[model samples]
Target: MSYLFDHPDKVMPFFWEHVRLTFTSLLIALCIALPLGFVIAKYRKLQAPVTSVLGIIYTIPSMALYAALIPYTGLGKTTAMIGLVAYAQMILVRNVVAAIQGIDPMMIEAAKGMGMSKRQIVFRIEVPLAVPVVLAGIRVATVSIISIGTVAAWIGAGGLGRLIYQGLNHDHTGKIVAGTVTIALLAIGADLLFRIVEKIFSPRTA
Candidate 1:
């Protein structure tokens, strides 16, 4: 609390560090999930198998995942990023599949009747209609990634987790509180921002 205000110089860097770690992993995850999700949505047969694998990955604990990767990746940001991306796959992919699947078949048929090509239909009709739901998934992924990212510091990845670990190491309550509050604020802020985005693109709004 007081530590945050009193030492903005020190705290701010870690804050941004955490932000970078979280968003970078999220971007990579999104890139992977979006294409995979589209493919799964297009092919119903692949959905169950792909989802099962991601579900298994998601179930693994963050720390455990980091440790498991340490031997190969040798720790630091790569290991953390890999773990973060893996954990996010199920949530992001599931949401993406649901968002695309939830669209009206009649709408797709209408687009086809109008002589729209598959690519045109996907980009022009499906994507616009699917944005809100995809954003919903992104919101969940953002909050989750932010929370899990703190653990990255344990493996030398560097984030707000360093503060908490440092506090525990040195018996400093202020650092712990500062880290906790900062993370909570980040999660809450992200949720609110996504809610706004969701509302903006909502079908009801249209």
Candidate 2:
């Protein structure tokens, strides 16, 4: 409480930094995942190999991935963003594949019967139906990125995690608590926002 009141400037800046890192990485992941996921889902044969590689990347420890990236990208947000984007790939790609593939085959057949081209069937029919699933994936990835963005502080990326690290070094309990609570709240808020969006895109059940 005291720590937060005393340092509103520091707290707010770091919180926004954390937001920037999380959302930027997610945007990159979505851009990469959507096209790749579409191709993999469409071809069928590419699914095993491509997703296997992304899964292996996701399995790597975050710290290890950061350490490996630092030599090339060096310290700062670039390296952190790369690591975070890599982490998001498996989640986004898999969900996208599932969403597109899960669409009703009958709907697709009908689209074809109506003389819709492959592009029209994909953009108009499949992509719209896949929105809920993609939003689900985005929700999961956002939470994960919020958690991971804390570690970005270690590499000088500047986030709420800095408070935790500083408090650990200086033994400032208030700062540590503030950082932890802030992150938890941020994750919860992001989850709720995405849940609302998912529901909006979800099919009506009535």
Highest TM-score: give the candidate number.
1
Candidate 1 matches the true fold with a TM-score of: 0.97
Q: Per-model C-alpha lDDT, please?
A: 0.93, 0.92
TM-score of each: 0.97, 0.96
User: Candidate 2's residue-wise lDDT over 108-179, tens digit each?
Assistant: 999999999999998899999999999999999999999988998898888888889999999999899888
**RMSD in Å for all candidates:** 1.0, 1.1
Error of 1 at 186 (Å): 0.8
List candidate 2 stretches off by more than 4 Å.
Answer: none
Instruction: Kindly list the per-residue Cα lDDT of model 1 for residues 1-206, writing each as its tens digit.
Output: 99988987877888899999989999999999999999999999999999999999999999888989999999799999999999999999999999899999999999999999999999999999989989999999999999999999999988899988999999999999999899899899999999999999987833
User: Weakest 10 consecutive residues, lDDT, candidate 1?
Assistant: 197-206
Displacement of residue 36 (Cα, Å) in model 2 is 0.7
